[model samples]
Target: METSDNATAAEETTPEPERTGIAAQDWATASAVPQYRAAVVDLLGALAYGELAAFERLADDAKLAPSLEDKAELAKMASAEFHHFERLRDRLAQIDAEPTAAMEPFAKALDDFHHQTAPSDWLEGLVKAYVGDSIASDFYREVANHLDSDTRSLVLSVLDDTGHGNFAVEKVRAAIEADPRVGGRLALWARRLMGEALSQAQRVVAERDALSTMLVGGVDGVAAGFDLAAVGEMFTRITKAHTKRMAALGLAA
Candidate 1:
């Protein structure tokens, strides 16, 4: 009877392995380090919510589509965004975190970004999908590099551009070809998107201590943190990438 009791007690006492997509050893290492764990949770939370919001926005954009084909494409993209969100949500759960709670902190900032940059037309939606999302993806990639290998891989994978790239580029470029003046208008709109994105991003950094620290705190001591010089250089690289993306769309930066 005592042996039976001991066996059951042992089973109860042994901790369950975490269910995150990353390796168990990696999860253990991240959990052992306070800053690393907090940063990872904060980053994943923000990204998961971002994808969920993107899914909704893309679905809304589908309603404004000019044709059945375009609406179908938008719906497909929205579905992909939801898949990404599911992956992130599962990853969060594996770590015993509440997916909705993790997502709550970022809701306002991301919603504000979309609200402030609401597209005026189908063309604007396409451009915003490509340009605005690309910038956000670039920033996420930059931060992912600072994470552990498994976590970094998961982050990059979820950040995948999906299947809308060539579609947006081709459509926007064709529109520019049809009306040269549209390029000028889009260029201005793109600039506004960039500006608003930067504003909201700065606000996010200012408000989220763990995330902002992750930017400058050097998670796991793997990459440079956010100092003034570092921040300036970061924006410089983002600007260069933005310019290239605009050029691809046949618009001025």
Candidate 2:
């Protein structure tokens, strides 16, 4: 009878694993380590939301394409974006944050950014998609390793492979060869779109601590509050890549 009682007591007292997508141990360790856990969590949450929002925005923009063929290509690009978004959402769930909540803060800012600087024509639409997606892919790839192993693997897996080379430079080059004047205006528009995105991105960061932490979460114990240098490197890589993209397309500045 005492053995039976002991068994029941043991069962009753045993702790269950956490369901928050965060392990209690991992959470406790991460959370207790100053602001490390929250910073990482905030970043994960923000990024997950960003992916979903980009997918939706790109899908809407796809409709503005002038040609049916271009429209279809844009739609395909949007589909790919959603695929990327879903992977992010799944990873977010693993960390115990609601996808929608993660994405809410920058929704309006992202929306307005897209709305205000919407492509004036199909070619411009292509440029935005081509340029934006390329930069985003590169950024994600570089920073993906910063994530814990599971997340690092997840980011890498989602990036399987794609063709920015064909779509951006080749397509843009073909168009330019057809009509050289188009290059100048398209190049100007690309720069402007990039500028707007950068400004609003900073605005969004300034407004959200969670996002800022996530973006610059841990930095060699430099907890001086988010490493601007590391983040700037990501931006620098993006700018350099964009410059290369512009040169390939024969666009000035």
Candidate 3:
């Protein structure tokens, strides 16, 4: 099992043209086929912009914090997101794709999601941090299995929460403990977040042929692509994870 640092080192050792060309072509052909390359760029682009948006959203959320300590904590998470965005942007350039161009297709869909589900208060913001972010992370993790090694490692690295989710869980649980009534509202809010996320995801897949095909490409030994049964199971897995996390915070899924 190569660590992320080890994988990054491996990625760096390749010479320039080959690194950006044959190596990529060989990896894509052997794994996802050449056409999957577009999907890879789309994936990386979406992730990069998502992290940048998260940084901005978290910074905005920090301003609504009740105390300096809380503000500082959110600020730290925001900073981490910015760093992740930088990594994804660099990865885009390494692949000879324009970062802005790759990310452009996803901007409207993501922006719409954020706008429609904008957090109404501190609790809502915290819930979005956990529920919304985790949904995106889970979807990416599913896609990562079909990616080449370097991209897989980069995706995994960027998705790491660095205990930010735990912090949200702790704060949310404590609030629920203090006032049981808050849990009901948050639960509803969480459901809304999930709905909006799924809606946007469906929209993306419907509009983006490459990304949709990649998901259904059945790469990595998936014999049937993402067929109905497979997609159903995927949703089940995501729901299970969401439920488990919510339970950990003493909230209903």
Candidate 4:
């Protein structure tokens, strides 16, 4: 009888499975660490602002569309981008972070990036939508690898293609086929966008201590072994992805 009682007690006291990676833990488990919480807030804030900016930019870019069909497609993508922004904003508030205040720090940087990389025409707009936005998405997806499961899921969901990539690819490829000279111009534009996007990303990391620490030193068990070497490798991967995107668009990387 005593042995049976002991066995029951042992089973009742059994520990939960150990969480081996950020993906194994939910936001409630991972956000217990102050630094990790701060890092997540910063990450979400930046992403929220980026989505909002993309929404606005795509709407404006629609004005440059060569046809009403193209304009309507861009409008649809802009709505999707706005929906993404709302998700991030709601998540921030659910975590008790002020949505606008959290997003404020990143607003200027994202605004400047858009201002600097403003596309001149319909084809340039298509290329920027495909190439520039994909670069940013790739970077965020890399960062998402270190996020807690809940946050990671939200981030990945919002990053889903809003049919923009295929739409941009079809339009840009058709333009290039129609005029090979357009391919060279767009390729040069894409390269410029890559440089600016990387610079903006580095600037954001440098300015946000919590985010930079999360990337370099990591927090809690997330990105536990991440280092400078890993950062270099991440960028190399992003560049390789960019080259493939350019190739798909019938442009030189």
- For this target, which candidate reaches the highest lDDT against the unseen true structure? 4
lDDT of 4 by residue, 21-114 (tens): 5547899988888878888899999999999998998999999988899899889999999999999999999999999999999999989998
TM-score of each: 0.86, 0.74, 0.84, 0.89
lDDT (tens digit, per residue) of candidate 2 on 180-208: 99988998898987777667666765676
Q: Given candidate 2, what's the lDDT at residue 234?
A: 64
Name model 4 segments beyond 4 Å from true.
1-19, 221-226
Q: lDDT scores for all predictions?
A: 0.75, 0.60, 0.75, 0.80
Q: Relative to the unseen true structure, what is the C-alpha lDDT of residue 123 in candidate 2, on a scale of 0 to 100?
A: 75
Whose TM-score is greatest here?
4
Q: After superposition, how far is residue 68 of candidate 4 from its true place, in Å?
A: 0.9
- 203 in model 2: Cα distance from truth in Å? 3.2
- For model 2, state the Cα shift of residue 64 in Å: 3.6
lDDT of 1 by residue, 109-194 (tens): 99989999999999999888887787777677666645666777788788765767667888888988988989999999999998
TM-score of 2: 0.74
Q: Which portions of model 1 miss their true places by more than 4 Å?
A: 1-25, 221-226
- Model 3 bad stretches (over 4 Å): 1-32, 219-226
Error of 2 at 140 (Å): 3.4
lDDT of 4 at 23: 49
